[model samples]
Target: MSSVKYSTRVNSFALGKGKKLPTGNEPILELIALAGTVPGLTSLELNYPEHFKHDSLEDIKEAIEKAGLDVPALQLRWPSPRFSNGAFTNADAEIRAEAVQMVTEAIDLCASFGADHVLLWPAHDGYEYPLQMDYTKSWVWMVQGLQAVADHNPAIRVSIEYKPADPRGRTILNTTGAVMNLISDTNRANVGVTLDFGHLLMARENPAQSAAMCLQAGKLFGLQLNDSHGVADDGLMVGSIHLAETIELAYYLIREGYAGTYYFDTDPVRENPVEECGMNIVRMGAIIEMARLLVRNHPNLPTGRALDSAPILWETVMGGKWNTTVSV
Candidate 1:
């Protein structure tokens, strides 16, 4: 089995899968304790402003320590209702500046926790209709905003998480290619991507291919592992909906020697959060192990042509043995 570092969304514990919120005064602490109960859960990825709303960072850190969990990353959350127009690309100049400031604050918070990076999901930074947004100027503003955030803290990284559309008609960085381009344009070494599997699926992208691209580009900062039906950010557990793709992605991540943490950005609306997260860790480990087995069983499985390797691939994956071969 691969020695993988597992983390999960802390809010999942308190959200109660939309059933009920934690009644405690310090819900963040309670949530941390609940999340820590999951075996093999190595660390946590928490939100900045939202998670800090009730408890102080000191209290949260103390609770995390008590739970034997490390804070690996702090996600910046800017709800759409507050910035429906956009975030970095908001039409109002002050709101854009405020968004940038919020990112800088999140960076500071991340540094305080010795976290790797701040996950920035530009959820509200897109457009609704054609001509509803000023393409060129908005792009410029985005670059400028990102540049400002990068300049705020050169030592810390800022990983951009992209989504195709939701809470908005279309997001600014909707695709992996677009995110790569943004990173290129931002011209900042610390700016990278936190590839969400479901978001990639929604964009009609193959997660394995995107992982390979990001890994090769050296901009693959982290991964938000989850699944969906290629339509929304369903945030389902890994392998629940896209098992093969998850396995393939794991294969590529292993092949590429990715050493970053796997954050379970999932939603356990109806299931126990702790159990669901524990299952996620187990499923990913199994997928990674199976990927290793596949590579070992067939050295030339991905032979640049799907038809050329489909037979042995299926045999090993389905039959658990490479007993047959096809040359064509």
Candidate 2:
């Protein structure tokens, strides 16, 4: 099994109202510096539009270099008012064209930062009324736009994220299966899927199963870490709930030789900004540590055998019957 690595998403809200970093420091530079302070973090995932202004890609790259941290991936929050409340699917041709340009520019920005992955969460692209939406037309527009973006920058990978809904009525790409179908239909190598744990929980989807399926489909490009209770997209710390399931998913990644950044993408809405940032690092470290322990302790667990026996194993471990079943 491969060793697990961790990375964190730098939430723009954590920067507070500071216009610049103190004593000859740029904001991006300061963020990279702060990221270095977190233990076991190999890379940083910067949110777009907020943390990464449209014209600051080069400066961001320079700051990342100065802080000696790698920018593995970027999250592109499409700067469209239509993105506010499930409207991307119904956006006009001009608005859609602008979105395409925004994403293309973001891809270029990612390439400039030496990061190949670009994550797109169409969180507000769903329909409140099922009958009001033309599924075929929306899918055509989405695929066309995405293909254009991919063609514009073949070197950069674009990942679509799935979310059931939150702060909104619905989301278009709301499930792993839906995302997989989109990728399949698009048939573009540069396009893939971003598996966000919080979104999976929000959709009542099993994270491990979703991860496994994405892996099998070869659509998984990156990962987002968070926790929830099968209800809302809480964005809680990883492994805070369903600890055993999380570990099992980690083990699956290790077995599959999945080489991608494990990014901690959380909301700063609940806790103190500074404390939440620090806690994210700590919680993410614990997740990696637990994953590592699972690989180490279960060295004899065959990959094929493990997949076949996963259900019973999960029930036994996560179902809280570990001691009785494993006792000699």
Off by over 4 Å in 2: 1-4, 12-29, 80-82, 85-88, 268-328
The 10-residue segment with the lowest total lDDT in model 2? 17-26
Q: lDDT by residue for model 1 over 1-328, one digit each (tens)? A: 4367898887678655565434434477888888879999989888768788878778988999999989888899886577888989989999998999899999999999988589898888888888998988988999999999998998989989999898789988889999999999999999999999989999999999999999999999989999988888888889998898898898889888898999898888788888889899988888888888777766776888876676665664587556455588
How many clashes in candidate 1? 0
Angstrom error at residue 159, model 1:
0.9
Against the true structure, what is each candidate's TM-score?
0.93, 0.81
lDDT of 2 by residue, 1-328 (tens): 1344567766523534432212222355565677666555667787666576433667767766666668888787764465654334555777777778878877877887778989888866777776766777888888888788889888899999888886557767878999898888878998999888878888878888888888887778999887777787766666778776777677677666678888777655645544655676665555555566556666766557755456545544455433335546
Index of the highest-lDDT prediction: 1
